[model samples]
Target chain A: MEKTILHLDMNSFFASVEQAANPNLLGKPIAVGGGIKKGSVVAACSIEAKAFGVKNAMSTWKARKLCPHLIVVIGDMTKYIYISKIITKMMVDYTDLVEVFSIDEAFMDITKTQDRFGGAIELAKDIKRRIKERFKLTCSIGIGPNKLIAKLAGELQKPDGLVVLREKDLPTKIKDVQVKELCGVGRKTEEYLRLLGVRTIGNLNSYPREKLVKSFGMAYGEQLWQMGQCHGASEVRPYFYETQAKSIGHSYTLPKLTSNTEEINGYLLRLSEQVGRRLRRENYKGNVVCASIGTGDDKTSSHQKKIKDFINDGYQIFKVAKSLLAITNKIRFVSVSVSGLLHQLDQISLFSHVENQKKVLAAVDKVNDRFGEFTIERAAIMSTGLQGKTGMVPPKLYGLRNFKMELRGIEPLTSRMQI
Target chain B: MVKVGTIIKVGVVFQGSKIIPRWFIWESRKYEVRSLDFTWEESQGLEKIIRFSVRDGINSYELAYNTIQMNWALENIC
Candidate 1:
């Protein structure tokens, strides 16, 4: 029997959630995005509003002009992420081989469990129906033999669409598809392929591997050919009640334009330690640390340091960051990324301080998880006083912390955030 | 990765080994089409341009407009 993969994607997820909750937003052109600030742009806009030329990444003001009646709403990530978590839970219950492709997209390997779920089509329909009834939003699903085709199939239809494709469906119908339809073929690739007189997938697949590799890079060219053949892996990642952190990074745009080193470092210090504790708790080790900052003038500066030997020590990262920040003066944004990750422990290094602090941080996390928040914070962190409010909350799991939705009724929380 | 602002139209759209483009755009301006793709030329005022292709079973003419352009597609054209 052939393998079965299902790709499920939510429709205008964030904006739809907002509109579903607020009855007034229905039938109106709605855009959900960053801020009213000039540089900020649309994150998601409704079908009605989309007709007005508003797009993701477009300035909110632009969207408004297109549809004078456009309703713009700032996003509440806490609520969206919470809902995403529950949806993930629903998918996991169906199969252990669930690959979380993104916050709102996932692929389930049901070839082995096909009989149990009635069939692939039945499973997809059930998932869609459940998601719509509970969230009052729509979704599109694609079923195929591999992850690439499944995702492609999902994209072929959208917003409450379902499409299933098999090997038998190819050639006559699939071969006529544009060259750009293949997975991972982006805009640049499409344009470049067009230059080569290759606009359809049928032509791209017929091109010899050597010719493709010569034109594009070896990796990309070969990958494209494989996509045409649908020979890639669709192996699903094991589903787990707990998930390990893949990467740890933090970015903050300066609340106010400033060149003050003290202010900058204070923020960096808090950010670094937060990253460190999370890494340690997950038993992760990172070898590369990057520091990126935007200037008040709108220009940006960034530098990264890779320790030949990696260490997850929060203070050490800060020590390195201090120099990275000194190179350029004015600041508007600051970000740090921890990479070259190792999944777990190795016998290579020993630090008593790390062990002790790891225990404390874990305990703190537990305490915070049980009782509303980080009711108890570190004294070292107190040195910065209060850092003020933030639009983003710490990355969290549904039940891990006080997963309250600023919008009431989304979650049964003790406190409610009103419009 | 069709972003929120990406523009698409109705007609024939393609992406590599797949010739099943259900939508196309007549205008050069980018769009962020919210619903089904696959539009016609005469109704919308342009010939054929699709930001991307999607399979909606049947590309409906219920969406037909002689200046068939979707309100979203027109916004970018301006």
Candidate 2:
């Protein structure tokens, strides 16, 4: 049976949310994320800012150069996460098979539920309307037979666009579009495809599969061939689906380039604690700890060490990370990550001190969870001047479990009668 | 923007699932909510705090209501 899928992409999500929250910011060019010092990159920008050629990931300085009056706002993750949860709940009213693609994008499989709303178009319009009515925000939604085509259709329109592209209409609708427009084709892949004279989706569809596989390798090349034919998986994993995290990491760039070991170690300790807290919260322990350092001259060196025992304690992770840091040059950035994960289970330590340490950490975790992140911190962190005002941390991705708003009791709105 | 974690009294109306903040008293002065621009919720452990971004005739303020404590606080101003 043919499946019906809808991809919904929020229009300039961060910027839009900021505008909705502040009446004065409405109808103005704005970007989210320059931190408190206004020295970082633009995480996202409004359509008004985009009109001035300001784009996401551009430096705030450059963005200012392009749009002199562009307002750069510090992001509030808690607010964004809360709104995202409410939006997800609204989507769940339509179908349980909803896959959150990102903080601002989602894919819903309404194959079984579309008929109840009369048809796919009606269902998509209803979702779009509900979102705009409740949040004063707009989204572009695409309706198609599979996720890829649905996403492509969504991309065809912007800021409250609704487009439908059936599998039968794929060839006519997208064949002339650039191969780079496909989801999986990145900059390097696009350049390689261009070298092969495959500029359009039509060219890729007719290109030799043998040549593709030989050039790109068997699995990915075969995948590209299928994408060229507009064939994609129809599966939409719901929020309840269990998924494992591969790694957990955090990195920070210093305000000024420094060779000071103590300051660098302070940053490392803070990052390690962040990683450890997340790992513990998720009941994960890892055997590998990796550390990286970036220098003033644009050089980065990284090292990883596999430990004998799995660990999730922040101090333990920090010890291993500190040992791995070589610090040959004056560095401005540092990162710490742990992988080789396993589900942590309750275990008794042979040493009494180790057991006591676990208890202490648990107590600390409880305090932080109750009050706020880093409510109880190490004295060393305070001395580093990084204690106050935590940066925005994006929610962990494991289905919709991280939303944490369901327990607050949100009553889903009843579906509108078919029109 | 200024961070003011000071606690203040707020008058609100609960209509179904919506929370409408009508007025708030801060620094011993009562300010009426000219507009309620945005609202959201955050969870800190077992407690859920409902936050509102509202504006008076002159200034904007952020107010948070702790569900467990049944109290309101002015969080920020701009």
Candidate 3:
């Protein structure tokens, strides 16, 4: 059966949520962004703000210049995530094959389930109505034969639009659209395509496949060709499906840019601890430790090294990161990550004493988990004034954390035999 | 706009599973919550705080309840 995919994208997600939360911001030009700082970037802007040519990622100072009446508000990520979860729950009620693309976008495979709700268009309208009624937020939904066309069709209209793109509509509907409108076509790709005299979807379709393949590699070239034909992946995996995580990392931008090496290392230790805690929580140990530093001048340098033994201890990761930090100066941002992961398994070592370290770390994790993150901390990070700082919570996409135990092949807490 | 981080006492009414802010006293002045516009939770280490965007007459206020501290704080007002 031909697939029927539906893509739902929230309009001005963060700004809309803010508006819904406060009635005063309704129909007013507002941008959700960083602090009133000079370098703060607008994360999302309302339709009113967009009318003034204010766009997301524009510097707040420039955005303010564009619209003198634009109200800049700091983004509340926790609030946005909460609203995203509520929206996800509503989508799940319609189909089991739902893929959360981001905090505010989701793709649903409604091929089999559309009949239960009249059709794909009816289902999309109902979902849109339900979300608007519940959250006082507007979204644009696209129904298509596949995900790519659906996403592109959704973008054709804004705020509260519902578009349907059938295979029959492909030639007329997408021919004039810019190639960049297709997913995976970034600035560089567009420039390359332009050099090859391919500017629109129609141009790409007329271009020779072998020449496009020579320009981009085999896989990507074919992918672009298919995308130009309005084709995309038909499979919509359930949001909870755990693709193996390649790396676990954390980075922090200091409140102020400082050249103080001690303070930088302190932040590095805190970040390393966060990464380590997540590694342990997910039952993974890694053999490689990577550290990256961003300087005040906006230049970033990173270093990674493979270790002899796989480890998930924060202190050990911190030590590796500190050595990498020795070569950099005037740093403003610090990050630590581990890759080359291995599924953690108990192994008795005759010469090594890693068991005691594991026990101590496990105890600390227990205490922290029971209370909250960073309830207990390492002595080195104590004086850094980083006590209350919990590194960014990786987005809990689709509330996947709720099914974490199941993914890890562990019994549910309620079902486990009590000790 | 008043910017205050002062701890204040608040009366909360639980309707089903929802926490509704009824009234609050800050700086010895009492204000009744006319409406709750929004609510969200944030965590700092072990401390979890639930913030409510509430309006009382002409003034809009942010009220926070700290789960760990077991206290209410008037975070900000506009």
The candidate maximizing DockQ is 2
The positional error of residue A178 in candidate 3, measured at the CA in angstroms, is 1.1
Fnat per candidate:
0.00, 0.65, 0.47
The Cα RMSD across the true interface for model 2 is: 1.6
Model 3: TM-score, first chain:
0.90
Give me candidate 3's TM-score against the actual structure: 0.88
lDDT of each: 0.64, 0.84, 0.82
Residue A252 lDDT in candidate 1:
68
Give TM-scores for every candidate, taking all chains together and pairing residue i with residue i.
0.70, 0.92, 0.88
TM-score of 1: 0.70
Measured with C-alpha atoms, the lDDT of residue A407 in candidate 1 is 16
Cα displacement (angstroms), candidate 1, residue A292, comes to 1.8
lDDT of candidate 3 over B1-78, digit per residue (tens): 356998999999989978999999987889999989888776554678898989897778889999888899998885
Candidate scoring better on DockQ of 1 and 2: 2
lDDT of 1 by residue, B1-78 (tens): 112343335443356843333444544632233333322121111222222222233322122222233332321210
DockQ of each: 0.01, 0.64, 0.45
Q: In model 3, state the lDDT of residue A235.
A: 87
Candidate 2 vs candidate 3, DockQ winner: 2
Q: The CA-based lDDT of model 3 is what?
A: 0.82
